[model samples]
Structure formats: C-alpha cells, structure tokens
Target: MSIQRIAAAATAALAAVALALAGASPAVAGSPHFIRNATTASLDGVSLVVDFKEAGLEAGAVETIQVTAHLDALYQCVNNGGKVPSDPKKTTISSDVSESDEFTAAKNGNLVGTLTVDPPDAASVLDCPSGQRSTLVSVTWSDVIIDDLTSGASLALTGTFSA
Candidate 1:
C-alpha cells in the first residue's frame, strides 16, 4: 500500500488515542515515534478539527508530518439537520512547501504527506518542553481548500503545538 494510505489508516485509528509524555527524557537518536496534536476551527456552518501526527523521527531528525482535517459532524447550520455534501471524501489538504503546496491528504481524511523540518522550524515544533520529551506537530490550515462547496467555502486554521 502507498505510504499515504498507511498513514491515513493509522491516523484514523489513533485519532482519539493520546500518547503520554516521558517527562524530561533525552531523545534517543534513530528511533521511530509518533506525536499527536490537535486544533479546532470553524467557519460559517462547518467546523473542523485538525489533527497532526509527527511520525518517523529520530530525536532532532526531520521526518514526515501527517495532517487530518475532520468535518465536525454531518449535521450543521448549513446542512440544517442534513448531511454535508458528498465531497469531503475528495477534499485535499496540503502542507506548504517553499511557496508551493505539497503532501495532499488521502481519501480517508489522512493527508499522508511528509515535511522536512528545517533547523528553525524544527527547533520550534520538534523540540520537547522542559518537562516533556515528545515531538510537537504544528499544523496551520491557512490554504486548505475544501473544494465542491456550495456556500461558505472559506476555511482556515492555525493549529500549532505548544511546548
């Protein structure tokens, strides 16, 4: 299976699972791991909960970041007790890369994409807190477009992981 597909499945399954922090432990190099973070955003009648997974990392090493944008629920103001359009399954969420878009989400709400975390960004997002030793996955949904919207199409989110 494609990497994206694998990531999507993992993300969906672990959406509600939280990983406990190891409490100020030194990050071991060459170890694969998972970090989870989430943020909520709303516009018009639709609400989104953006979940992030920083996976496949070895301490300060750079790796792929998985993003998931979920439609809060089927019934909302626009839908008026009805389901949203049948297009969320086709909606694509991308991570910004050097003035371009990269890492589109898969069909199952898993934007299975990898981002190379540079030194500066890495220092902020990947660095664990004083009493924590887990990666922080930051996700800013500035340009994520939910195509095939009939109205109230604008959607944006600033979901960052706090240290």
Candidate 2:
C-alpha cells in the first residue's frame, strides 16, 4: 500500500478504538454493581385476647390482653450473609365490638386504645460482584381499635406496609 494510504488507515483505526473505549468506559460507570430481589414473609395462627372489667359507670371496660403471632417468609436472591434487612416500622393490635344491647351505657365504647408494636422485619443478604450488602425494611399497619359492646366482641388485625 502507498505510504499516505497506510497512514490514513492507521488514523481511522485509532479513532475507532478511541471512540469504542470512550463509550465502553461510560457504560461501565453507569452499570450497577449490585442487583436486588424481592423477599416476603407471613405470620399465621396469631392470637390476641381482650379482657373487660367494670370501670365506674361503664361496663365491660377493657383492661388488657395477651398478644401472640407466628412468622414465616420466602426469601429470594440472598447474598452477603452478613447484610440483612430489618423492619423498623410499627404494627398495631385492634379489636371490633357489636352494640346490640339496650342496657349498655354507651352504644360504642373504646374498649381498648390502639397499641403500637414493632415486629421483626424481613432480611436478606445482597449478592454483588464486588461483595455482599445488607438491607432493612419497615412494616406498618392500619389503626387497630377495640370497640364498645355488650358481649361476644370480636377482634381482627392484619399486617400492612406504611406510607
């Protein structure tokens, strides 16, 4: 090949290499080093009780009750054994009551006030190319209250996420 032609070809190749290197370097910077996956847990067969006592004029006033729950979960893509997620939010315990009795002082009574409790949060170890990481999550619930009533009052509560 002619000298001028050879020099031009070499310059073109160098330019192409430079462009590829620039593009590739930026892509590497933009690429994420770590990946994440979803995990879930559930607690079943949980139970709580509400006790009632006569308070002044009001009847069947709630004193206190025991609370218990079972926990379960399905974990996915857990790496970095040391790093795990935990729940920082609060859970609530509530109750429901019926007012069919005519002799009841109040149609509905605040048998028990809302009580906030924190439960263990979901955890996972994030696996990454460089290393492992830890993550924490928060759990929350809606308002849980015990209503007023005569007898056979019922209570139900469910877990939820916070806003």
Candidate 3:
C-alpha cells in the first residue's frame, strides 16, 4: 500500500484506541459514597429453661441433659442491586451451661452439638457486595435433666460468637 494511505490508517487506529480508553476510564480510587437508612423489626425471643422432675433423692445420684440451638441469616443484601446468599448456620456454640444442685453436676458444662446450616467462614456476605444486612439466630434446648438432690433444680445455656 502507499505510505500516505498506511500513515492515515495508523493515525485513525490510534485515535480510536484513545477514545475507547477515555470512555471506559477506571473508577476513582476513593471510599464509596453511600446513603444510610434505618429500619426496625420485632425481635424474636428464644430461651432454654429446665426444671428438675425429681425433688428429693440420694445426693450421689447422677443426671444427664441434652440441648440444641440454631442460627440463620434473615435479611437480604442490597448492593449494585440485591442478592441473598445461602443463609449460613453457626457450627458451634461458644458457651453452654447446665445448673443443678447435684454434686456431680459440672460448674460449667460443655456439650456436643451440630449446626443445621454451614456458617460463613468470613465476616462479609458471599452474594451481596454492598451495605450490611441483618441475620437471624435461633437456639433450642431440650432433654436436660438434673440428678436427685434435696432442693429444686434448673438448667441454663449460654453462647458466644466469633467475629
């Protein structure tokens, strides 16, 4: 091809490249500007209460208790649009306890249990990429019993979370 023709074609290609880059420039590297809003919802209450069936028996008698709890994510994430990842479950309870008059009873008890859903490994949500959202945690307690004692008995369970 002629030199003039080749030079003209090269100039046109360079101009097109510059225009494309200008149109698709990278986003400014600064904190994202956001608008905040607050909303309220009724808090769902959950508790585990245990009462001793037997009042009086030998002091040495032993008793056993079984308990369980649940954790879940209730709110949807709103980001570029909106997304809801699978609600992760809490795998382990940080704290659990049973109180009784029996001498054999543990001062503080730790029990073996399982989580119905898989808990997210990280702090942020998987599907949502924007503002923070709310999640629900449900815990249940059952099959707790206290050994024979001179006085009435009861059980209590507690839990802690890792951030």
Candidate 4:
C-alpha cells in the first residue's frame, strides 16, 4: 500500500532468508549444490532399511549406498576352545563383530531404501575360536554410518543407533 510499508516488508523478508541460509548452508565451503535436504537420516533394524527422506541427492541418479556399523552378537559354540561348533544347545558364546552392507540405490529421487549386506545374518556361522558357535543368538549394532559412496558423502548418525 504505502511506500514505507512496502520497503519494510521487503527488508524483513530479506533478513529472514539470510537467516535461514546461514543455518542451512552445507558444512563444507565448496560442497555440492544439492546438499540442502541431506540433514535427516535413519536406520531400520527390523527391515534392514537405511532410509533418507527428501535426501536432496542428485535428482534421479544412481547412488551407491554404504552402511557401516559395530556389531556385537551372541553365539553358541564348542566350550573346549575349538574352532568348530560342536554343540548347539547352550548359548554361551559372545563376540564383538563388525557388519557392513553396501548396495547400489535405484534411481529413486532421494528416497533411498537399500538392504544391508549381512553375511552374518545368512551364514550365522562363527569360526568360534574358543566359545564361538554356529548360530547367532543375538545381534546388537551401534555407531551406524550411512554413506553415499558414489558422491563421497557420508552421514554419521548422531543418535548412536539412529546415528
């Protein structure tokens, strides 16, 4: 309506945009342009899905998704310090292991859902040096990382399991 009112409104809008950009800019100075929506991330243990919503990856390009985490599992194995698991009845073996799963993401515009390459899940056989076993009794993971191998971009989860 009035000249003064219009100028004040434009200034306020400009200030708001500047503030938002200050917070939303990429961490690195020369980072890629499409890195705006890559902030939020998560890991689904039950479905083994590493999900990124509105990820802001290259619009429809194939992304190589790599996930790494620390794994601790309980197993059942021979009790007499044997490599081969001779028994399957007692759950008396525990080992600290690492599990990493990588897969090529389909061309799905920033919505990345890939299955983890879990050898331990399928094989379930522990060499079981002493108290190791042939069966995976329980599995726990921590320090999870979801990385875009194609773009050399990685997101270290902040919430431990979700982190």
* Number of the predicted model whose TM-score against the real structure is largest: 4
Report residue 131 deviation for candidate 2 (angstroms): 12
After superposition on all CA atoms, how large is the RMSD of candidate 3? 30.0
lDDT tens per residue, model 4, 46-102: 223444432444445565566666655555554555543444543333333333344
Ten-residue region with minimum lDDT total, candidate 2: 32-41
TM-scores of the candidates are 0.19, 0.23, 0.23, 0.45
- Where does candidate 1 have its weakest 10-residue lDDT segment? 71-80
Residue 126, model 3: lDDT of: 30
**What TM-score does structure 1 among the candidates reach?**
0.19
Model 1 per-residue lDDT tens digits across residues 17-59: 5333434444443323233332232332122233333233333
In terms of lDDT, model 1 sits at: 0.31
Candidate 4: where are CA atoms >4 Å away? Answer: 1-48, 78-109, 117-124, 127-133, 159-163
Error of 1 at 88 (Å): 21
Candidate 2 overall lDDT versus native:
0.32
Candidate 3 lDDT tens digits, 47-94:
333322322223333444332223333324433334444553323343
Relative to the true structure, candidate 2 reaches a TM of 0.23
Task: Summarize candidate 2's per-residue lDDT along 54-142 as a digit string, tens digits.
Answer: 22223333333222322222222234565432532222323221212122322233232322233333332222234433232322333
Clash totals for all models, in order?
Answer: 1, 6, 3, 4
Strongest candidate by lDDT: 4
Better of 1 and 2 by TM-score: 2
What TM-score does prediction 4 earn?
0.45
